[model samples]
Target chain A: MIIGQIKDGIVLDHITAGKSPEIYQILCLDKLDCTIATIQNAESLKMGRKDIIKIGKVIDINFDVLGYIDPGITVNVIRDGKLAKRERLTLPERVTDIIKCKNPRCISSVEQELRQEFRLADRERKIYRCIYCDSEAKKQI
Target chain B: MRHLIDIQQLSREDISRLIETALDIIENPGRYSEVCRHKKLATLFFEPSTRTRLSFEAAMYELGGDVLGFSESNSSSAAKGESVSDTARTVGCYADIIAMRHPKEGAPLVASRTAGVPVINAGDGGHNHPTQTLADLLTIYREKGSFNNLTIGCCGDLKFGRTVHSLISAMSRYENVKFVLISPEELKVPKYIKTDVLEANNIPYIESTSLEDNIGKLDILYMTRVQRERFFNEADYLRLKDSYVLTPEKLKAAKADLSVMHPLPRVNEISVAVDDDPRACYFKQVLNGKYMRMALILKLLEVAV
Candidate 1:
């Protein structure tokens, strides 16, 4: 599939297959007034199969959400149809507004304006927990 | 400490030190009477938590400090839709330190961030009850002599009890502490605590629906009331309350040295007859709460400046 190349935007590459929609939905990429294409089961030299999301305009992204969903994902920034920079994500120590605290009594639930935050409790297990209640925070995306 | 939000943040050594400090104050109350003469503790309760709030106020008072603030959400600016951050920032101007108990978890954390002083979480929803856990640790050390190699039976509402959660997390930091989780399947310990705190820490633990089976081997029998507030149905609370009641008959099966503890305001979880039992230490837990609060206030105010 010719998903097209980014001229001046972000290319979210190496997304675990079948997770691009979640990233797209989470980032609200479809609502942006710019060209965005998602190619599923894309050919990869490193990964046997991957998902790629190409945005045709420069826009801000929530890296914490992207990292939480799949830490192995890579991003390449294009400027003037040239690869400006390449970025790879790792699990962050703490993230805000990436995951919701599942515990019913968590402050993030009652205090609507407060950011939903989580911390990587166990890096090996890829376990993130609500910063407030310490409950395990599942990635809805 | 800038914030006493979680018992998990406190090491066994820090707990021991605080317990020792509490004990020291207990022995010679006159020595530290005026330790916090000019200090003030703001008891900001956005929930109806009289016991915890009273314990905090009593602690501040006994330490020669002043106390201030509202007891319920309706009484405060929160009733007028004021945010916790705004209230905390406003309260910070009037009080030197804060002891907050909110129905929402991490409300104290928000206070700690903006309060411009140390914040003690009296009890924040079901997230934590660090002060109560401090009282429990002190009581356990006094009764069991050591936290190591002891079988602690945590009975009742483990799922919703912040005291049980904090106590388990705190005691797990000790050497060779085993947890006998005695509760109905519906009230089993939360998964995160089981997996993250207990399993991850490699602490030995076993779960059983029968409290009597585990009572015989326990060094500490921590009884918690099955809160009516936690149940969606009144019948469920009524049915489950009888399942965990600690009576003299049950105590007969327990070790003679077993320390029976409860965070008070008991809604018939323990038999009133058990109050006379030698193993009963729930009343002492009340006094310990006072002393621990005193120790906490002194520690916070000592470094407040």
Candidate 2:
């Protein structure tokens, strides 16, 4: 397990192992942020195995992406080399911005400029419904 | 709901709400112009369907939203090796909604899993066409005035007709709804329709190889095509194709109020002369498709509202 702490930034710990790339892409952190360290297959007490990404800035994070990518991730705001804020991510009750839907033919997939929106219909299964075309995604199955 | 995969998932009340919404849009079109203002609808049609695709875009346009997306598979990224899920995830980032039609079974289902936006299955391979089902329901309500105590004659290809199957499944929910399955012996209604929809549900129905023989008995004549490609041999196609044609002369044998319907882009299955007949409701069905879709959009949005 590769373990290294960030000098001055937020640490995203307890992400589901092997889901780092999806998190990286969804957050759009490839361009603006610097000194980002991504570690996978790290052992954790909470999650038998985990992934962690430490970012070196206070840039606004999209809690939605964190909620969607991995609900198990613990977002810790680090200030002056000390942990400032720590909380487990919770998926939003209603998603105003959807990243995907169960329907392949939805306009959002074809167009280059629309934001996907969904309502969390069944929280336990993570079932989401698209507002535009009314497609359902059953996350559990 | 991002993807409409199957009609079995929707309740009867859900179907009614969709139909009522479509009727409202038909009755008052202007009221929904700006309902989807600043929004966009993307249509990804892998198969060629000029009518169905247009109806979906029209539904969005009527709601004051703009439309974008491809009408054919060759014109889009599908020609490349991009997986449906990969393409869907990328597009979900851009569009607010998506409606897809593919020749492969469960293509839209795969899209729904990966898409970040809402997805509508326009039609899948001989599977489901829920939107078209809604159009049929609205057409029945508008033309026949009610769905109860009616006999529907489903004429033409039964084995491969998605519309026919969907219509039968929907009408089975109404009271005293009987089906007159009309087609050549070679093109008879599938056994699944008999065992699954009619028999399982105990809906009254009969199968026949004659169209005009029972034309006068039906309240609605539902016409479908006998595709030459669906036949195994050229001789079989030649033998069965003419068996289902609905000519104007045959109209005289039908009830005066007997409505004729076709989920159409008719290629001789229904004669052109029949278009001018008062009983013809196929063209009106096209108009009803747009209205029904508008109703669906409004209802889904209201859930979000």
Give the number of the best model, judged by TM-score: 1
Over the stretch B147-234, how does candidate 1's per-residue lDDT look in tens digits? 8998888999998898999998888888898999999988889988898889988999999999877899888899998877767789
lDDT of 1: 0.85
What TM-score does the predicted chain A of each candidate obtain versus native chain A? Answer: 0.88, 0.80
Tens digit per residue, CA lDDT, model 1, A3-118: 66667999999999889888999889878999988889987888888998899887888777788888998889999999998889998899887777777777777674888788
For model 2, residues B17-95, the per-residue Cα lDDT tens digits are 7777777676777777788998777888988889999999988998998888897888888898566777788888888
Off by over 4 Å in 2: A1-141, B228-239, B303-305
The lDDT of each candidate is: 0.85, 0.78
Q: Which CAPRI tier for candidate 1?
A: medium
Off by over 4 Å in 1: A1-9, A28-37, A56-58, A79-83, B303-305
